[model samples]
Target: MRIYLPATVTELGDPDGLVARVVHAVTPALRAALPDEDEEGLEFAAQLLAADDSLDLLGERPDAPLRRVVVAADVPQEAVAPLADDDAAPSAVRLLTAVPWSDVACAHVDEVAAAEDVTAALAGDEDAADRLADRDLLWFDVGELARLAAGHE
Candidate 1:
């Protein structure tokens, strides 16, 4: 199954390392919640949810750059389970084990120009957060992750 993992630039230090457990994927609940959306739409919705969660990750690593990162990867279906938290997003899930970097397919990340809004959003600015939600993240191949983490385009 494919999943979207919330992350930060600095967290990509090792392109072949393990990622956190939390991820977002199209679950049955997400399908039920957005019954009218096509598969592509649902997937995009999950990615957006992951992007929002990325903000929380950024808050945890103050030394990390202020940019949202969503790692899209293909993992075994058995590797993930729906999150137990009732308050979690419809697409939220928990990985039963660590996800290896090799499983990652690509990444969607905020461009450098989005850093200002990302900074304010992390500081609890609602408008800044809204602006971030409206922005489109740039796509990067799995091979570019190391360079991205190094603060290069």
Candidate 2:
């Protein structure tokens, strides 16, 4: 199963993929939420949820750099299971095991150019936060995640 894992840049290639993330799918709930939504919309919604999960992770780990990170990983379908009921959201699932680096297809992270803005947003600047939200995550090939995790600038 292809899943989106929220993460920090430093954790990009780590074997442990458990973090504040929601492994999402086109569940009946999601369909009900947007009856007209197509496959592309559902995928985008999952990505957005992954981004939101990254924010939750940042909140829990204040020492982490201020940036959004989401890893697109492919694991065995059997390795995943549906999450329990949550009226707030029903499209989420859980990964029952750790995700090795080899399963990662790519990573989406804040661009170096947006780091300053992200920092400012993290400091509680509403305008900066809004602007930073407008910025999109930059995609990096999975092979590059190791380099990034190795303290590359």
Candidate 3:
């Protein structure tokens, strides 16, 4: 199953340092919620949900740069468990094991220009959050993560 893991750039400084337990994926609940959407659309919805959750992760890591990162990985079917309806968003799932770097396909991240908006959004600025919601995160190949994590993006 392909899962979207909320993350921080600092974590990506080392492939082995990127850690995530709760992830977003195309769950049965998500399918039910967007019955008419295509597979790509469904995956995008899950990725957006993961992006939203990434903001919360940023809140906990003040030392990390102000940015949003979502790692896209292909994990085994047995690795994920969809959360109960009342537990989380429809796309949310719990990972049963750590994902090795080899499983990661790529990442979606906020551009450096989005830092001010990300900072504002983290400070509870609704308009800034709305702007972030409308912004498209830049795609990065797994190989470029080390450079990105080094703040060279």
Candidate 3 residue spans exceeding 4 A from truth: 85-87
lDDT of 3 by residue, 44-140 (tens): 9999999999999999999998889999999899988767659699999998888777899999999888989999999999999999999999999
lDDT of 1 at 71: 90
Runs off by more than 4 Å, candidate 1: none
Best by TM-score: 1
Candidate 3 global lDDT: 0.90
Write down the lDDT of every candidate, Cα atoms only.
Answer: 0.90, 0.73, 0.90
* Candidate 2: 10-residue stretch with minimal lDDT: 13-22
Rank list by TM-score: 1, 3, 2
User: Model 1 over residues 1-153: C-alpha lDDT tens digits?
Assistant: 999999889878764555557899999999999999999999999999999999998888889888999999999999998788999999999978777778889999999999999999988999999999999999999889989888777
Q: How much does each candidate deviate from the true structure in C-alpha RMSD?
A: 1.1, 2.7, 1.2
Please list all clashing residue pairs in model 2, or write none if there are none: none
lDDT of 2: 0.73
Q: How would you encode candidate 2's per-residue C-alpha lDDT over 1-153 as one tens digit per residue?
A: 567777887687465544433566556777788788898887667776777677667767777777788888887878767777675355677767777777778888887777677666666777877786687888889878877776584
- In candidate 3 the C-alpha lDDT for residue 30 amounts to 93
Candidate 3 clash pair list: none
